[model samples]
Structures are given as C-alpha cells and as structure tokens.
Target: MRKLLQPILAVALGLALGLAVTWIAGESPWHVLKILEKGAFGSGYDFGMTLFYTTPLIFTGLSVAVAFHAGLFNIGAEGQLTVGALAAAVVGAVWSGLSAPLAPVVAVLAALLAGTIWGAIPGWLRARRGSHEVINTIMLNFIAAGLTSYVALYLLKNPDSQNPETRPIGPGYLIHQFGIFGGAPVSAALPLAILAAALVWVLLWRTSLGFEIRAVGQSEPAARAAGIDAGRIRIIAMCLAGGLAGLVGVGEVLGNAGKFKVGFSPEFGFIGIAVALLGRNQPAGILAAALLFGALHKGTADLDFETEHVTRELSLILQALVILSVSADGLWSWMKERRRPVIPETAGGVTC
Candidate 1:
C-alpha cells in the first residue's frame, strides 16, 4: 500500500505546485479550473468526447505499464502505435468488400501483428545484442515517423479527397455506436478498452505467465537463478506491450475516425508514460489516470471556450509538473512531513 500512496501524494503536491506556478505567471487557479470544467464535463457531448479521447490513452498506458513490469522501457510504443495504425488502415481499405465481421477482424489482427513486430525490434536488439531499448525505441520512433508519413503522403493518399489519408474503411470495421449519443464519437471500443484492462490485470496478477514476468522485472539475476528465461520473458513482455499499443489504433480507427489519418496521433504513446506514472502502474490507478487525462483533454476545449485568458498550452505545463513531482517523491515526502498530515495507507511499491 505504501507504494501507491507516495505517488498519489506526489501528484497532489504537484498539482498544488502547478497552481502556484500558474499564479506566479499571473494566471489565476480559478481560471485553470474553469477551463478544465468547460472542456471535460460541460455536457453529454463533452462527456462523450472525454470517453472518446480516453480510448488511446487506456491502451497506451497499459503498454508502458506492462513493459515496466518486465523491467524494460518500451519507448517504442509511439512507433508501434503508428505502424499498427498504418497496418490497420491498409487492411481496412483492402478488405472493404468483405463482411463487416471479417473485415474488422482482419484489420484489428493486422494492427496487432504490426505492433508486435515493431515492439519486437527493440526487444530483440536489447536482449540479443545488449542494445539499450531506450536508444533503439527512440530511433524507431523516427523510422515510424518517416515510414508512416511516406506511405500516407504517397502510397495511401486518397485519390479524390484533399486530405492526407487513406481510402475510407468499410462500414463493418467501424466502431459500433450507442446511436443515442448523436455524433459523440463514443464507440464500442469503450468496453473493449475496459476488457483489455481486466485482461492485463489478470495476466499480470493472476496468471503464471504474469508471475514469470514480474519475477524477472523485480530482479533479472534472481529470476535467472530461479530458472526463468529472463531474455525470453523480456521479449514476450514487449510483444504484449506492442499488442496493447496496437489496440490504440483499433480504438482510433474502428472507434473514432473509421479511417486512418497520416498524422493522427499527437504523442498518445508518449503521454501514456505520464499516465502510468500517475497511476503508479496499478490497473486501478492506470484507469484513474487515464480518466483524469481524458477529462483534461475533454475539458481543455471547454476551458478555452469559457475563458480565453489562459491557453490550452498551460494544461501541458501542468501535466509536465505532475509527472515531475510524481517521479521525484523526496520533495513531496518532505512537504508531507512538514504538514504533518497522516499519509493514508496506499499500495506504494518498494522500488520507489
């Protein structure tokens, strides 16, 4: 429990710190709050958008969390997500004549496979050649950036449309709608995201495979001594992480756009690291963090609409602050000790 509390406390402290920074910058905290409220929860439309925005974040956050559990940093999630999206887009366009069920199934599978391959590159480099995943994944990001753009701009460009996107996907591959919520972009992916989270939790906590991964993550040498294949485990963990990130493409294409945009992702994979940190890498915490980010994404528009005084860029500043504070707990601990508030018992992990 102690593992979880410290991070939560750190975020709270960071939020206060962000507010202070905003104040010093001549912006009122109230203005910040107003912007958040306006963007996130103003109406059913806003709420729907919040859920919509959360789709990619949920999968991406789990991607990082899973890799972290294996003691590896899958910074290549951005590339994985992009490649997966590209794969899905291609499949979506090619299989347009098939039955809806088969078309979406193919597209989603292609996305997963592409993501797995993308993730495996870094994993393979790290395990076999002893290359740092951080370096390889960062490099992969550029490769994906170049490749995805090249294809989108040339090979996949829509023939008749002015937009830089591929041909429209089949209706079958599109995310199902509540229909009740008109044009909200809320799709069947919500339940899928939740299911993915549950599966991840069960895989990490209940399954023997999860135990193997965690054991390696806790300590590679100890895991090797216990007869576990550390390198294999790392590779598997990264593949699964890639698959999870690829699901983000499913959520975006099948659920939101129903087609692929060349440059759709605005660093959802990168932001996921912050979400995982805020949640302390726990499933419940990850969900909460995703929702918080979703709300922030949703509310920023409202915040800007209600009060044009502060730009949405300020929200980015706050996000960075929260991440810094959560990652650095000593500052929060000292402050908590100073305030003398009883720290609530939490699942605070020992590694911190």
Candidate 2:
C-alpha cells in the first residue's frame, strides 16, 4: 500500500505546487484546473488525442523500466527509437509492394531489430569494456539523429515534399484508426501498447529471467557469487529494452505519419525516465504514469488559447515539479531508513 500511496501523494503535491505557481502568475488556479480537465477529456477527440500521445510513452517507459530492472539507465531510448522508426520507415517505403498484414509485421520487426542492435552496442560496451551506459547512450542519440537525418535527406527524401522526411509508405503499411475517437489518430497501436504493458508485467513477475535480472540489479557481486552471468543478463535486458523502445515507431510511422519525419518525437524518450521513476519502474505503475503524462501533454495544448497568463510551457514546469517531488520522496525514504536503529544479532540469537 505504501508503494501506491507514496506515488499518489507525490503527484498530489506536485499538482498543488504547480497550481500555486499559476496562481502567482495571475491566473486563477481553479480556472486553470478546469481548462486542463476540459482540454484533456472534454470530448472523445480530446481523450483519443491523449491516448495517441500516450502510446509511445508506454513503449519508452517499458524500455527504461526494463533497463532499470537490470540496473541500467537507458538514456539512449531516444536514439533507439529514432533508429527504429527510421528502419521501419525504410522497410515500409522500400517494400511498398508488400501486401497488408505482412507489411506492418515486417516493418515492426525491422524497428525492433534496429533498436536492439543500437541498445546492444552500449550494453556490450558497458559489460565488456567497463564503459558507462549513460555516456554511451547519450552519444548514440546524436549518432542516431545524424544517421537518420542523412538517410532521410539524401537516400529516401520524399520527391513530393521538401521536408526532411521519408517517402510515404504503401497503404498496406498503414494501421486503422479507431472511429470511436472521432477521427483522432488513435489507432490499433493503442491496444498494442497496452498489450505490451501486460506482457512486460508478465515477463517481469512470472519468469526466471526476470528474477535473474532483478538479482543482477540488486547487486552484481552477489549475482556473480550466485553463479549468474551478470554480464550476459545485462546484455539480454538491454536488448529487450531497445526492442520495447523501438515499438514507438509502430505507432508513429505505421499508425499516424505513414512515413518517418525527422523531428517527430517531442522528446518522449527523455520524458520516459521521469515516467519510469514516477512509476517506481513497475509495469502497472508505468502505465498509470504514462497516461497522466499523456493527459498533461494534451491538456496543456489549449492553455495558450484559453489562458491569458498560462502557456503550454506550464506543462514542462509541472512535469519537472512532479519528478522533483518523487525524487525528494525517495531521498526522504532513504534517509529515514538510514536513521532507523538496526537490531544486532549475536551468536546466541539476539544482542542488546
């Protein structure tokens, strides 16, 4: 219960702080709250848009969470997703003649494979060469961005448009959007994202590999002592994390854009770190955190038009505050634990 209660309280605190900032900025807190609520859920279209924003976050959240379980901080999710999205776009456009069903499947596989390879490079470096994953992942993000830009601008530039984007994929590559969202681009990708979350939960909780990963995360020395190949587990966990992050392309390319755009991502990968942290790196918690972020993103879109003082940038402030709140909570817990008196054990049984 503390696990759940803590995050909820942290969120509330963050929201309260954010709203107070708005009040100080000469906006009524209540008015801002109403606008946020309305913008996020006032209509089916709005809600669908929120889900659309959410789909990729789930993928990235799971990606980070998976790496976290293996004691890895996957800062390279942006690069992984970028490479994966480009790979999917390349396959979808190059194989335009491929029939439906098979087209998306193959493209998605390309995405996963691309991301896995990208993620593996850092994992292998960390495990074999003692290179830090954070620095490697950050470097890879730049490489991925440059590589994708070169490919899109030079190799597969759309002849029809001057934008730095790939050519449109074949119709077969497109996924169907749900009509229930009032024509919002909420697609089959939403269900796929939810399914991915469920599968992640099962993998983390119901499998031996999960235990090994968690064990390695808790203490590499202990895991090695227990005869677990900690290095191998790290590589496998990173590979899985990359594949999950790669699924973001499934929604962006096949579901919405039908092509790859150079700057399509609004830093979903970076925001995912906060999602994983807020969710406590658990799958179910990640889902809830992702949805909250998605709603915040969608809700803030209207602030510029509706409020005199508040702007969409408020969303960034809100996100930062929430992350700070969670971090402070964790720090407080750690301090409390450290200050707690430990009962000593003696050879006989207990020691005073």
Candidate 3:
C-alpha cells in the first residue's frame, strides 16, 4: 500500500503544482484541467495517440531500469537509440527487395546489434579502465548525434526530399498501422512494447543473470567474494539495456516514421529517466508511469490554442515537479527523523 500510495501522492502533488502555476499565470485552472482531460480521453482517437506515444517510453524506461538493477547509470540510451534507428533504416533501405517477413526481422536484428555495440563501449570502459559510465555515456550521446546527422545528410538522404532524413524503409519492413480509433497512428508497436515489458519482468525475476546483476547492485564486494564475475555481469547488463532501448528505433522507423528523421525524438531518452524513477524501477510500475506520461504528452498538445496563457510547457513543468517530489523522499524522511523525540541516556550509556 505504501508503494502504491507514494506514487499516487507524488502524482497528485505534481498536478497540484501545475494547477497553482496555471492560476498564477491568470488562467482558469479548472478550464485547463478540463481541457487536459478532454484532450487525453475525449475520443478513441485521442486515446490511441496516447498509446502511440507510450510505446517508445516503455522501451526506454525498461532500458534504464535494467541498468539500475545492475548498479549502472545508462544515460546514453539516446545515442544507442539513434544508432539503432540508423541501422534499421540502412538495412531496410538497402534490402528493400527482400521478402516481407524477412525484411523486418533483419532490420530489427540490425538495430539490436547496433545498440548492443554502442552500449557495450561504456560497459567495457567501466569494467576494464574503471572509467565512469555516466561520463562515457554522455560523451557517446554527442558522438551519436553527430554521426547520425552526417549519415542522414549525406549517405541516407532521399534524393528528392528537403528534410535531413533517410530514405523510406521498404514497405515490407514497415509495421502496419491499426486503423482503429479513426486512423490514429497507433501501430503494432503497442503490443510489442507490452511483450517487451513482460519479458523484462521474467528476465529480472527468474534468471540467474538477473540474480547476479541484482547481487552486484546490492553489494559488489560481496558478489566478488562469492566468486560472481561482477564486471562481466555489469557489461552484460549494459548490453541488454542497450538492446531494449534500441527497440525504440524499431517503433519509430519501422513502426511509425518509415525513415530515420534527424530530430524525431523529443528527448524521449531523457524523459525515460523520470519514468524509471517514478516507476521505482519495476516493470509493472514503469508501464503505469509511462502511460501517465504518454497521456500528459498527448493531452497537452492543444493547450497553446485552447487557453490564452497556458501552453504545452505545463506538461514539462508537471513532469519536473513529480520527479522532484519523488526524488526528495529521502530528504523528507530525514526531516522526519530530525523531528523525532530523543530518549535520555542512563548512566550506563543505554538509551531508554
């Protein structure tokens, strides 16, 4: 109950903060709240859009959560995702004539391989050179951005198009969009994301590798003393983390965009950190948190037009507040501890 209630309270606090901000800006908080609700769920189409936005968040959230279990911070999911998308696009474009089923399979494999390699570099550096994963991952993100941009602009750019994007993938590689909900761009990726979440849950709870990862996270010295290869486990965990994040590419390139766009991601990778934190790094919790964020993203789209003062930035503000509230739990607990009554010590130095 505490676990459930904590997240609920955090979300409530975030919403309240957003409402207060709205009121201060001279907007009717009630009207904005109603607009958010209507935009998110007024129609089936709106709901589908929410789900569509959620698919990639699920992948990125799981990626971060997996790394957290291994006591690693993978801030480079954005880089891994970018390279994975490029790989998928390259494979799909080059092998456009392949059989329908085989094309997507090959493209997905390319994405996984690319992401795994990108993620492994940081893991290897951490294990072999004792370099910090945080610094390495952050550096890799800039490299990936530049590399992908160069490729999109020169090698992959469609001849007749003005946008700095790759050529469209083969139709055979494209996941069919579900026309349910009035042709909202929801695709097969939603079910795939759910399956990925279930698979991650099983992997973490039912596997020896998972045990080793968790053990290393809890106490690396103890794991080393017990003859577990903590470094190897960390590297493996990082690879798996990257592979999961790479699936975001599959959703975007093959599932929705059909090409690798230069600026397709709106910091989905960074936002995933909040999702993982809010979910407490649990798969089930991550799914729920991702859905909430997805709804926020979809619902806030119309704020610019619907209200005079409110804008879509309110979503970011709300997300920031939630993250702050959840992350400050330790501070709150420490404050409570400071306020607790102290028992007097006896002459024997024992406290009553």
Candidate that would win on TM-score: 3
In TM-score terms, candidate 3 sits at 0.94
Candidate 3 per-residue lDDT over residues 242-281, each given as its tens digit: 8888888888898888899997887777778889989999
Q: Write the per-residue lDDT of candidate 2 for residues 174-200, one digit (tens) a residue.
A: 988999999889988889989999998
lDDT preference between candidates 1 and 3, better one: 3
Q: lDDT of model 3 at residue 250?
A: 86
lDDT of 2: 0.92
By TM-score, rank the candidates, best first. 3, 2, 1
lDDT of 2 at 32: 95
Q: What is the lDDT of residue 120 in candidate 3?
A: 94
Winner on TM-score (1 vs 3): 3
Once fitted onto the true fold, the runs of candidate 2 whose alpha carbons sit more than 4 angstroms away are: 329-331, 334-352
Model 1 has an lDDT value of: 0.82
| TM-score to native of every candidate shown | 0.91, 0.93, 0.94
